[model samples]
Target: MIILLIWVAVLIAVLVLYLRQIYSRFSRYGVKHFKPVPLLGNMTRILLRINHFADDIFSLYRSFPEEKFVGRFEFLNEIVLLRDIELVKRVCVKDFEYFLDHRSVFSTSDSFFSRNLFSLKGQEWKDMRSTLSPAFTSSKMRLMVPFMVEVGDQMMSSLQKKIKESKSGYIDIDCKDLTTRYANDVIASCAFGLKVDSHNDVDNEFYAMGKLSSTFNFRQVLIFFIISNAPKVAQFLKLDFLSETSKKFFRKLVLETMENRELKNIIRPDMIHLLMEAKKGKLTHEDIKPNDGAAGFATVEESAVGQKEINRVWTEDDLIAQAVLFFIAGFETVSSAMSFLLYELALSPDVQEKLAQEIKETDVKNGGKFDFNSIQNMPYLDMVVSELLRLWPPGIGLDRICTKDYNLGRPNDKAEKDFIIRKGTGVMIPAIAFHRDPEFYPNPDKFDPERFSEENKHNIPMFAYMPFGIGPRNCIGSRFALCEMKVMAYQILLRLQVSPCEKTTIPAKLDRETFNIRLQGGHWLRFRARD
Candidate 1:
């Protein structure tokens, strides 16, 4: 009789807890707006469909246009979604210190590729950024021009093979697949110093790994959330962030590369060589010696005393982590950008003709070569890429964690109460929302490259156009991604004409499993060789 009573009491407690959680999550806002659910919050829509998340938030913004920032909840955690462009600038750039760390799933012991520049924080991130800034300068990128050209030539040759096989006047192919192959090959050469023939070999190892990184299943997304949201629990339970198979393959590949490079004394202009240089404490040609007590015989002491400089204080794991991120970021972002570009070009043939003309003019200026200087000065191409980013960002949105307490600017008349932001709060800057705002961008839905024109660009507010995000923590590989995309487009446009097929969707739907912006259905196009 006593045991039975205890069991009944336990059951009642659980039921009450569950009911309380549900009530708090679905509670509607009386004045400001509706509150998000407890554990699930707005995530149910995200889990159900990617387009739904974008649509739901867009609808919410339309419903509460008066509110400067909307109160939202994700997995029971409260987040503020900034609507006003001025306020967004304050959150993402002007007052960046308030939100320093990016929300990510990582631990100290994760694979080195897992903790690169994208997910690092505080002093460590600052140090890494400062040290690596020199590597991406114009001089360095110029040195890499030949390397890029080699890859481009190889890609063009592969495309010729595909055209030959088609025999038909035009080929019906998925441009997305071809672009992804090209991107994987380029990044592999740059990161691992290995040449991947992904264009020729569909089942190439590098290509397979690249595809696997972003191919998250339904269960995997759930697991990723559990690990990301509550890392402490995951750690206690020894939960894995990456699949065991992926972890093993990447670890082995990185290890093998390090071993071979060290043994052969090989040197390349890629990221791996730069990282190896950091390990050797020979980043540059400068030489220095430690200071000693002043003495009459300064010459003798100077000769005896050695340099006190410590070698670069990063581990091999650090290099691996950085390289992995470069591979993933460089590979995926560029591919997506190309995919969007194709979709737009296919929809608008006039745009394609104009782009091809620009490419030809630029190529002629470089003495019949696609040189660095020539590629960098293509303004119309820049406009096209910018417009593409506006329509389809590589990532869905940028997220930041509050490092210190902050305010959502001064309160307005409607809700005349200051938003007291506490530390540890998550601040979400919706790239899609800002890009689609009709206020900042008139006729936001239209695909017009002229919007990014120099004359009209000033009209758009500062942080309102952040496809690659803003502030000090912006995407480091923007240059590389842009360069590759431009080169690929330049090469392909010179030969083929792009047009939308009967099967093309007006607005491509995004996949929900992965957080980054990607196509749910493949982007297909018909390509005809120009006479």
Candidate 2:
């Protein structure tokens, strides 16, 4: 008993000393920051499930009003959160090579998750980016629009069926689920070259595989933290972040699909077909598809780097990894974005009315049929989608790993010297927090689309709004994603009027325990037929 007690005391003392050594880093460097707890670091509230992640970040970001950047720790790992617009611009764009890759979240040996374009590092990443960029060009997006519109029509039909079956005149929906199903079909048709009706075939294997892959439970979360904090340790132990079931399922699907296509010489306007063309060096950037009006605020332009040719042979697993990443991103992320946008439309009736008016006008102007050009050209639709991204970005906070030692100038005027950030350190950009700052957007909490309006959009500070990220390594799929989002909003509003229901929270507060951005009670909204 005495020996056991002694060992416990010694272990606690050692832990205390270790924490002090790490926590003192920011102070020693003269950087401003909040005091972090021992194990949870600055994320105690979030890790402990006491406070919502968004609100916690809101408090931390606002707490340091005068700071250019603040130091933070995610359990012993150092993070510098940039607050200044110029610093953000430098890290994300000007000095892009210095911070070239996203920090590792899983062991690199995990081919499915780690081999995807998002996980590839250095020159490998650059090559893969160049290869994949042609598939996401404006012309490619134009080709995929018909597939998206087809999915939108299916979703509308599904909703109409539900309304007819409802005892009440209106059908109350968990917009999250509705959007998830819609997004599932869109990704299926566009990315995998598979046609699916998720609403009709509720228990489809593809949908099941997507949910299994994307939804992270507590064990997965813990595994992610372990892998993120100590990659070498996780790799040494062969800790797999993704389940073997999901890995095998996605691999077989991709391989079999490729085999069938190759055997039959199938021609389809989808990502799989594009990727096969990419493998043969036939996928090159085409002339930008022209639209009569603005391409919307959330759209990302194709850079010269994206257009440059590259030569690298891809393994079959590499092909599978990209498809699976596409599935996860399209299914989980775009679905959440759709849910949030629907939530906003329900809460703000006037905003909904204006957007509904635009949808109605555009539909009528085009002789009661919508096309890629007609939908993409709506300025008001663009503004609303932009605002939705601002209020609830797909990735609330993201980090970039420094590849070389770089100076971050100074934390503020009072600092004696520029802070030299070492190689391998992560520089976090709290984009959602910056978007919510009152200094940048007055009455920041209000769901106002006018902030992105043609007359007022130039007023937005640079790097303050990056829902699809920024820089050369920014989302290649941003244009594709925006197309998906806009199409759904257009389809739903044309058929139904969204309004808050009994299950909907009045001033929606983000759920504390969720990894994803979700509402407290639920994202519940009533969809009544438009008169």
| Model 1 C-alpha lDDT per residue in residues 405-509, reported as the tens digit of each score | 886653345554567667887777778888888888889987888886778766767677777776767665655666777778888888878887776766777
Q: Candidate 1, which ten residues in sequence have the lowest lDDT sum? A: 293-302
Most accurate candidate by TM-score: 2
Model 2: per-residue lDDT, tens digit, 1-531?
A: 999999999999998999899899888878988898887788677677777666776777788888899898877888898888899899988999999899998685655889998998998888888889878776777788889989999989989988988899799888988999999999999988888999899999888888888865555666776788888888887777567898888888888888899999998989889888878888865653333123467776655556668888888878888898898988888999999999999888999999999999999899877767975679899999999999899888878999999999878788887889989988888889998988899999899999998799999886888898888877878888888999899999998999988898888888775677888777899998999
Clashing pairs in 1: 25-37, 25-38, 112-321, 113-321
TM-score of each: 0.87, 0.95
Q: How close is candidate 2 to the true structure, as a TM-score?
A: 0.95
Clashing pairs in 2: none
Best by lDDT: 2
Query: Quick one: how many clashes does candidate 1 have?
Result: 4
Could you report the Cα RMSD, in angstroms, for every candidate shown?
8.5, 2.2
Candidate 2 — what's its lDDT?
A: 0.85
